[model samples]
Target: MKDSTQGTSPGPGTPLPDSILIVGGGVFGLSTALALAARHSGKITLVESSPTIPNPHGSSIDTSRIVRADYAKAAYATLAESALEKWRNTDWGREGRYTQSGLVLVSSGDQFGKDYVRESYENVKAINPDAVEALPTRRDVERAAPGYGSGLHVSGGYVNWGSGWADAEASVAFARKKVEETGRVNFRTGDVKRVISEDTGSAAAAARRKVTGVELADNTIITADLVILATGAWTGRLVDLRGRAEATGQALAYIRISDEEQAKLANMPTVLNLSTGMFIIPPRNNLLKIARHAYGYRNPQRVPSPADSGSNPTQTRETTIEVSLPEKDVPIPQEGEDACRVALKEMLPAFADRPFVKTRVCWYTDTPKGDFIITHHPQYNGLFLATGGSGHGFKFLPVLGDKVVDAIQGRLVPELQKLWAWPESPPAAAPPPPSSSSPDTVVWTEDGSRSGPKGMILMDELAKGGWKRSSSKL
Candidate 1:
């Protein structure tokens, strides 16, 4: 996690564009802005559609998100370990923003969760063997957290005391404040309509054409030599990520617990059952949160083909393409609610039937392998993509931006470069269900971390509630 530009002059490479514009202001956008302003003296402008930095509708605005270096892949595990050190010792995690509540990653059946957790355990064990304890059975899990209700589904897992959860909204706000304090980045609020571009040569040249700027929803134009799309779930709408990324809505629900109940479960570590993709974080302020990390619901919409959106009319005909985009302020579908209920029944039986105080469908910019797309666009020149959090990017906020800046400057370590590069031939997206015509571009994250059914439509599932569901925990 060394700052690549901290010591030396700019390396020999194409000079960075004098003016840089960033779209979207979630973890990726703000963090990238923070790093750029810190290391570069160029003009940096960050444009977010929302009036504020932490858009309430954004996925990163949740109450809590797991912050751990226990990743199945050695690369992410290594990178997350560096980020963890910052969270533990730096001001980035000050003021109640981070809590070392510990994490219990478990799995019951012979699904991918078993292998994933095993791989993750070995990885974390390497980082800090002293902080990681292996749980060999359901009883071991119970002993670690006596507060859990009986009949837990965990067969085996591990507890990493060094891991914790981050106050997502607070951390994001901290990033914004830091970026503002730099007094280097200019902030703007605008709804970007499309990337402003023109055909430089023949029709074939459209793929390599450079975007001079972006056009806003209000017909306002913000010109820049470079445009970085940090847009999260909405990224598919702005770029032709036909097979690279899509938006998936994960379910999250909160229950209000009495002071007594909160006290009873005070310091219990977060429990995650990868076999079922359900997780329950200990209560804070008498509020308990239950969520899933599965192949979430989709809300696909048709939009003008991004490749041709701002190109010459004659060079390319205006055509529509379907991309899974975020549907905001939406309630969890009945399917998701049922899953949450099951998870509650197993984790905290006392509150199994309690009504949820609030529920939300958190959106993620998912990639096929659950990798973040942090490299330059393969077809579009002068454009870079920093989206594709794939449900795990928030933990890297402390150092992710510096890594992104490194990538932009052509000096990122070789390992991350390979992980974030555009797929040469991305796997064909899983086809839509027979009954529906989902966006052919919809890519359900097939990373071993995901569980539950795939290709579920949000509206369709909402309309068909009360269906039979697995009575086990979420």
Candidate 2:
């Protein structure tokens, strides 16, 4: 975390090691591969757990994800604006992949919610004055998007026509095709058992571990000069990110709407309520989606302590640690369904009683400040991390790789270098790490954009099942 921000062009790759292995084929992984293949001549291999490029279980493979430059943080807002340009001007946004349906961010009068909406208005207005409108009351919000029920639980908000949503699956497929055209990257499929490492010194005595490669679940080993761990939510299985990052499940439900209903709401702006952590995008293809963007549920599982990550490790070798991993291809639990159902009642009274045709528990790799971890391990050489999407990484799909490559080569801009670097100390928003050897801690993100229930366990909620339907589709 040196002063890499000064005197560096945040440009393309700089010919990394002769062999580079990127783990996971999701947003961060595929995008990184596409960028690397374009700039580097060395051998580059991309490995994925799923045979297909758009893994159905991945968080990035959803129907739609918000793409907005309306962020309270100026840095992310500016970066998102740059990405919006690509989604608007380049082929990256073609073929129904990107839709500028606009977005209205409303809040329920809480201090944090109000402050977040207010600052986001200021930032996005500065970025695009033509499409910005400030709604200072609930009536004003209803006026901005008449499709939304007039009885919304918001005090004030703003609408940014500059923002939009992206087709997550299509964009990932597009990225994969782009990488394949390069013909410089080798693709492999395997579930990584663990990252293999070698250390000159003992586990103690301040030893530095070098990751040679990864060992697959079938015991197949692949060696490389550099290994980029962009495994998204599953990164904790290969690295000890107890306090820094972990997987949290967010709830979403899709309902069937008639053609007439779809036409009426299809082009309406997306509405997100910060206080309740709920939102709804316009219906498409006779399907409407509602989701909660809150502090999500954690599904804790016992896993072997991952690599040291050059960070200090107190645990002895060959030990098991319980961390939150993804419960893929599973339906969201009763509590989440209830939350979404209640929000539907408030936001769209017409669809409040309709049964959800599908429900999903999308997982997010959350960090304390919602900042992505995209730098070399502070303690391990040849081990780089590009994860911690925290539910907002999809919009950056167009340009995430270029920035990642820049950071890899130490040419990233000064501002981004500071934001993406490995934390020297525990973040203020991060829960305090467990004092004992037990790695039991809750990661409550206080980035001011999240709300709703906290500390709900995934299994516990599923056990108390009360779905409108007997079985829910994945």
Candidate 3:
């Protein structure tokens, strides 16, 4: 087999058409494009109007985050295991674990969360028996890390040798680097106002109805055979998001713990306080990250309808971008911050005297069941959906990427069968792209083909320069 890290090669048949298009540059979108490019060399193009990884509106970025395989289901567990192996063994850049800080999940004795924790522990142990241990009581939490409050501990806890925190930004950049090396994936700066699907009938239709290309606000049509929308917060409006968008919203809080306070939580595993809906991630560079995993209630219908984006240019159109609305701008409540502070102090009194050093808001695209909705849209034949991650989706991204790639390739990923499925009936036709979407820019093609290594370098320069002009507002 060809080296997976190397750029893709033209497959059998009329040298697989040289063009493939991707809509979002967030980690998922970029990673998918990278994976495909590494496997099949083609003219790959990724459109992202966001200046960087977090996409001012992106949900992928965080100061520090955890990655582990503690899941109630086998598929999710397996996916996480894959990601863990990749991060640990691959030089995807920055190492993704805190060797010293253990990861912990706590729930009340009678709560439903106990099952989740217990299942997660048992599942992880099944994969690597020698490395996992269970701590059944709050007393165990205190005993494992003295001075820790019994209040924070609960019915169960588990420590696994392989799981821990990683620098989110670095991990993303590392993946981005791989995308660039493939030479096929090119990152371009432009807001997509239209996704044009050619109307072709038959297996030959794959070649005919392939994405004719996208129309930007500038009105230039960039053509491609396949399109993937990975735009984070803006995805719902840009595409037919189904029910996932309605449940998504932004969250924020400031962690006031100090080095001294962290010392108390140090060597401590990442804490999931189910009772409070709060998680106190271990401190990174002297700061603690705290937030709740409560249900989100943002208006998903706010995203502009694509029909409106593709229709009459002279007409005025409204987009359901709630985060930017003045009314929705009412800040994430201070009470949320206060609650986090008090919880930290309650669990580790050492934090009682310190104040938060920094704070910012982020989003969680949620689903009603509190689990992820990784389904496919019925309207768009080749389009695949991977939203509705809810709050705890980050740790599973690498594995999730694999599932997404499988879906994109039209494979039946069993692990995703439960969490992801296409709707039974045909989806109503999507509205044309809204007029407010970005106007198209002139499409640029590679002057010539180069070996994988040379193509990879060229692609990186294009993405860096192409995406530099993107907005911070996303």
Candidate 4:
């Protein structure tokens, strides 16, 4: 990992606090820590619940994540554009951590008129005309991808040649290493229990709530002038976000293929089928990944059982934690599996019969709307938030830290200040469950009634059966 701080130093004006503590070691936490360490003459300490920077169960911990500028909204498109530039020129770029295989956006409806795909293409083209190639007809798509002509409908979309993917886990590790080498960052292993605040009395309380530091689960308090909560899915568990965000568990699966098969499918760009919310990433180490990008299932908040009393029980009789215990594992829901089958059959028929090599449920800290929450706590003076990835944040790995720095320094433009502020009202609740008769149309629900898709089984169960592929065709 290259030291991004070598050529840069903090500006003479507006020096940040001398000591900062950042919780969570995922993309947001590591990136922000690196950014601050480069510019501020401060001591930065990053804490991770897990022993590693890129926790195995982290949402950002995966073989690959799509890095594209094809977003319906211009803000994300602009951010992605800047991030891509850095990815291609930075140390990670030089190390082959980012693969520039391009991305293909697919839509089911007529691609000519106004729609998500059309808007995305227009946005990217406006940013860089030569960055995308419009595939206006099926022939054009077929020429680009031969096997996609079967069940996939490529009405009107473009290939973002400037976009690609990043080795997610590797990127995290590399950034951590670079930050540590600077001799300014201290990385520690600990689970943050809650943010610590001090009362400023009734009169001063109206001014600003004073945040002291944070308390760890092991009963240790690490005090700092400023504390940033970058804990992705677990953000809600620590702070009273007022329904601004929730932890959602999305489905992801990997399919194994032979080297020959990998070579044959090497040219297939990362496919994001907007209609079905299914995305198929290109092969990495002979494994193709498929994931769902729609409204994922909410983890059930758990309450401690009252029947048992032990000195070191996992859960206390009065205490409760959210679902997805650190050791708990979940499988791909039937809905996700069906979506992948439908997508592969239509877009990449060659992978329809490939055996599933691995399956796991990845969690995302989703906001009511897609925008991120990177603002200071309205009530806590020394507390800030760098969360709300919304499942699409990893793509901004290169430039996101800079924005976080801007937020911390009170230099954000009016537009961004308003965009990243806490929501005025709580987001609407999840939609009602679909009729049981319409199994395919039903979405995941918070209640156990629709815990998972019909006939959903754990990966452990499938592993016992050798994880075989079904012979039936889509």
- The collision pairs in model 4 are 151-346, 152-346
Encode model 4's per-residue lDDT on 231-293: one tens digit a residue.
Answer: 887776666443566666677888988899788776677877665567777777888888877
Give a tens-digit lDDT track for model 2, residues 1-474.
122223457354454888999999999999899889887889999999999989888988878999999888888888888889999999999999999999999988764578888889988888789999999898999998999877698888999998989888899999999999989999999999888777646655355678789999999999999999999999989987877888999999999999999999989999998888899988768989999989888878888777454344444577777888888667888788888889888889999999999998899999888999999987777889999999999999988998888888887887887888887765444333343232345577778998876677777778777433224342
Q: What lDDT tens digits, residue by residue, belong to model 1 across residues 70-96?
A: 889888887887888899999977897
**What are the runs in model 3 whose C-alpha is more than 4 Å off?**
1-18, 93-100, 198-211, 244-247, 250-252, 256-266, 297-303, 307-331, 369-376, 425-474
What order do you get sorting by TM-score, best first?
1, 2, 4, 3
Worst 10 residues of 2 by lDDT: 430-439
> What digit string (tens of lDDT, one per residue) describes model 3 on residues 243-279?
3343333334555555776676656766665555566
Q: Between prediction 2 and prediction 3, which has the larger lDDT?
A: 2
For candidate 2, the TM-score is 0.92
Per-candidate TM equals 0.93, 0.92, 0.74, 0.83
Return the lDDT, model 2, position 72: 82
Model 2 spans > 4 angstroms off: 1-15, 201-206, 307-316, 425-440, 466-474
Output the TM-score of candidate 4.
0.83
RMSD of each: 4.4, 4.0, 12.4, 7.8
Segments in model 4 whose C-alpha atoms lie over 4 Å from true places:
1-14, 110-114, 147-149, 202-208, 302-328, 434-474
CA displacement after TM-score superposition, residue 441 of candidate 1 (Å): 3.3
Best by TM-score: 1
lDDT values of the candidates?
0.84, 0.85, 0.55, 0.70
